[model samples]
Target: MSVWAAVLALIIERVWGYPDRVYRILSHPVVWMGWVIGKGDETFNKPDETSFETGRLVGAVCLGAFLALVLVVTQPVARLFSALPGGWVFEAAVASSFLAQKSLGEAVARVAAALREGPIEAAREAVSHIVGRDTAGLDEAEISRAAIETLAENASDGVVAPLFYLVLFGLPGIAVYKAINTADSMIGHTSDRYRAFGWAAAKLDDVANFIPARLTALLIALAARWIPGAVPGGALRTARRDSIRHASPNAGWPEAALAGALGFGLGGPRAYKGEVLDLPAMGDGRRELDADDIDRALTLYRRLLDVLLGATVACAVVVWVV
Candidate 1:
């Protein structure tokens, strides 16, 4: 099943590629669904115990229903889209929607562009989409640091992880993973209301991403040597040493590897929703993050994407031939 899925995905990637229009359309449905479901929590959310428990119950049921709807809906939608005039075009659109290469690049590029246009404040605002940290009052280096960290982290979570699941189980797998991840992002935290209720969602996402995160780190390490001034051996060694230090057991691996590969440190103390959390750093380098570092991280991410695509193709061919 995995091999077959990989083969099909590879074909779509090579022939079709991702299209912006497809993403725009898909986003409408997915985001609207999330909004409708998420709004219930916002409306019912209250300081009282009864409201908290009720919100949790509603959230859980909504998430489950959403997941089921996506699974049921995507097949027909994909089939209908597949029937469009140009076969290659439709295939490319499907592949592109599934792939995050373009989206990730554009996201990071927007932050860089914002920084260029204005200042750290601009960069902070632009980067908030990709990161969870508080952005207010961040210095230039801090803003750059956040963007680079987000670039590296999303390269794993937003790109490689989805592709890994797509190759393993097709669109349903990818959709399911996205739903779970979205749910985690919505409520998974150590907050007063979510500590117990969100535990299951957080843990499930952790387990789902475990192998993919490490795989992404390995690819980043391999691609790092191509980056000028990067010490290949040192980067890999540091990645191994530092990946486990972050709060998340899975997120640290890729983020640490990218930090080491780019010869910078990431994942330090930052504020979150008025709370100051002392997060562990990811690499042993000095804190010298800058716009150039963001560019370098982007370069590394592009290379990693190419490596992943090539590997997927090879695996597909091997499976098909065998």
Candidate 2:
């Protein structure tokens, strides 16, 4: 039943992609989580006064509280769904709302479309919405690189990690993972403001995403075989050699895999909040990325999503029969 629910959720999300009206009316689960994280930060994460040890404690306490709240809410909801007729469909819808597959594709596609049809400024605006790097001074190649990198990194965080948890531990699994991920996104950083206070959130997110990130890399490598001009063997080799080069323990896997897939360099130094981060490049391929490259990355992303969906269906069938 859980597997069927996952399948239904994937289908629903692909078809509807979380309508704007729905979002306007109900906000989103991620938004709800963000509000809680913000309040926690405001209350406990005082940058000037809070020491590293205190910040770590506060962060752990806040994360523990949020996890407790998620379990409390989702456990009963799962039970309620089990009680009612055809209630798994409702569970499926709730689960689907957590995924960003179609939305991610749409967002990346917008950057490509803007780059193709409009000025560099337009494409920059579109890419800015998805990436955290400084976009104000990016040229066309830089803009395309940023968009493609965001697409790869978020594919693991926004889609595969949630689905991985869903398959492993059902609704509560995904709920808990999303809460942690939301915390990481809201507060996780290296700035003095978040360095200590966001430690637990950031570390927990890394732990949760470790396996899924590697799985995403492998899947992206497999997807490269189907995309023209992409070399699967090179993707796998590059991922193995360069995944650890990025600052993050998890994000680099997918980003490196995608860089290799597209035969381009990514994850070089970039600015954030006016400070330049001297990050290492992921691939030794070409550095001259363009709009067409963005389109190719999207094709790989969509095909990877398809592969994940097909795998989900297979798992669901096995669970149903066994």
In the range 52-75, model 2's lDDT, one tens digit per residue, is: 999888889988998999999999
Ten-residue stretch with the least lDDT total in model 1: 87-96
Q: What does the lDDT read for residue 118 in candidate 1?
A: 87
lDDT of 2 at 181: 94
List TM-scores for all candidates, in order.
Answer: 0.83, 0.97
lDDT by candidate, in order shown? 0.72, 0.90
TM-score of 2: 0.97
Candidate 1's residue-wise lDDT over 37-135, tens digit each?
A: 477457644435556566566556656666788779766655664466544344333444555566677788888788878866678788888878788
Using TM-score as the measure, which candidate wins? Answer: 2
After TM-score superposition, what is the CA distance of residue 43 in candidate 2 from its true location, in Å? Answer: 1.2
